[model samples]
Each structure stands twice: as C-alpha cells, then as structure tokens.
Target: MTNINDNHVDDHSNIISRIGKCIKQWFIQDFDQNSGELDAAFKNNMLVVATLIVAVTFQTGINPPGGAWQDTKVEPGGHEAGKAILASLHLPYNLFLILNTLAFSMSTQIILMLVYNKKLYFEVVVATVSMVATYGMAVWSLSPDKDVKLRYVFMAALFPYVWRLSFQTFKTFFINYPTK
Candidate 1:
C-alpha cells in the first residue's frame, strides 16, 4: 500500500535530513580537529568572564556611582553621605539598586554552577545580561542629561544576549564532543 505522495514526502525529508547531518558532521569534525582543546578554551573563557562579572557587580553594588551613604553631614563645607553617594546629577537610585542586586545574584549563580559541575550553558547568558543591565543602570543613573537617547546603549546591551545565544548554539551543536 505505497502511496505515491508518501514517496515525494520521504524524498524531501531525506534531503533535509542529509543537509542537517552534513552540518552536524562539519561541526563535529571541527571539534575533533582540536580534540578537547575547544572545551578547555570555552571553560577558561567562561571562567574569566564570570570573574569579571562578579567583580563588576561587587564594585557597582558596594561603591555605586554616587558613593556610599555617610551619616555625617558637613556644614556646607563637608560632604554629606547616605546609603549611597550623592550624584552631581539626578540618581536613579532605585534602578541601580535593583540592577546591582540582579548582577550579583547572577554572578553567584555562575559560581555555583561551576562548583556543581552542571552546565546549561547559562554562565555567559546570565552574566552578559547582568553586566549589560548593570552598565545601563550606571549610564542611566550617572549621566546628567536625562534627555540622552538610550537607543545606542540598548543596542549595545542586546549584543551580549545575541552573542550568548550564538555561542550556546554552536557549543550545543558540538554537544559532548570533548571537555579537557
């Protein structure tokens, strides 16, 4: 009971499958060429990024752009302080606080993932987003001009997300090729 229509469908499916197989094979060969070196490189690279992210988050959260708040008030000559420093310009205090928290949280998670030996390829994505958000918060809070268009900053932020997705896709394509 062979339907002629089924043959056409199978033929099309076979072609698609072959194309996919070729792509998979290419990536595998590329990885094989490097043996386990790529995996080590990726891990090392991720470690570096995570470290930087943690540092950035820590610094931003602790010092912030405005500075830490001090209770001592100066009589028009001494500097006043609060939980955070006073900005020469308007400060998006609330926004920075939230972003700083998120960045720190994500950084902590990355460290946990490393310790647990678990990989969802989440390090780059979460870290990148956290870092970008922290940066945007800084730009938003510290910049004196509120009228400044943030389209460029927004676009720059998007790059990390895009790069993360692209990297994970490639890494997943190789899958368990190697890790040394």
Candidate 2:
C-alpha cells in the first residue's frame, strides 16, 4: 500500500510538471516568419478577419449599448443630449468601452502588420488614426464623466503595445537567458 501511494504521488507530480511546461511553451511560442508556411493566402485571410473586427468594433463604438440620450437635462442624475444612456451604469459601460477599444487597436495592428505596400500602409495608418480619433470623439460625446472616459480610451488603445513590451521583456529575461 505504501509503495502504491508513492507511485500515485509521483504520477501526480509528473502530470503537474508537464502541465506547467505546456503553459510556458504556449506563452513563449514565436511566430516564425521564415517557416515557409505563412504564405500570401494566409496573410489575406488574416487581413479579412482583422478588417471585419475593425468594422464591428467601429460600429459598436458609434452605437454603444443602451443607446444614446436624446434631450438635454439639468437636474441631478440627468444626462445631456447625445450622451450614452449606459454611461449612468458606470461599470458595465466602462468594460464595454475598454473591450471595444482593445479590439479596435488589435485589429488595426494586424492590418498594419499584413500590409506590404508603402503607399497603402501609409494610407491604412492614416485611416487607423482617423478611426481612433472618431471613436474617441464618439466615446467623449457619449460619456458624461470626463475623467474616466479618457483613462479608459487611452489605456485600452495602448494595451496591445504594453502587452507586447511585457512579453518581450519576459522572453528576454526568462526564456532566452542562459539556462546553464
């Protein structure tokens, strides 16, 4: 019985160690550009998916959940015209804005990555900036609270860059560092 219990313990430890390695490998997996697998068709498919994401996110930004305020009001708990009705709820509205902005940012990044032509790339970048600005304005006009809205928009927009920086830092210090 004692020997059987020891084997069970060893099996559990081995399973846990394997799971840990798999999780680490998943995070550290790199996109091998020269692997001869990422061809033009794959790039085109990715671009189409990214473009769809951009469109969906843009639509949501313009027409947020809970709709918009129609008339101006001065009383407490009352909102101005053109503001979002969901703004009053605070938490859900903030989550919705942040997630939507993050989706928009990531989709735009994918589009930028896939475009090879210089002129087209430049045009996409300009359009991306314009879309971001329009989204910001839509959020601004819709949200009643000034401080929180700006924070959410900027944080969500920069999250992809921040995420990449963090991953690079981890890969450098932990994954690529001398293991000996």
Q: Which candidate leads in lDDT?
A: 2
- What lDDT does candidate 1 reach at residue 8? 100
Cα RMSD, model 2:
4.1
Please give the clash total of every predicted structure, in order: 6, 0
Decoy 1 TM-score against native: 0.38
lDDT of all the models against the reference?
0.56, 0.79
Model 1 gets an lDDT of: 0.56
Candidate 1, which ten residues in sequence have the lowest lDDT sum?
82-91
Mind giving the per-residue lDDT tens digits that candidate 2 earns over 1-180?
A: 369889999999999888977766666665543234467788889999999999999889889987898898889777888888887787878888899999998888778767846467888889888988898788777787643566867899899878877866766665656332
Off by over 4 Å in 2: 1-25, 32-37, 116-119, 146-149, 169-180
Candidate 2 collision pairs:
none
Instruction: Identify the leading candidate in terms of TM-score.
Output: 2
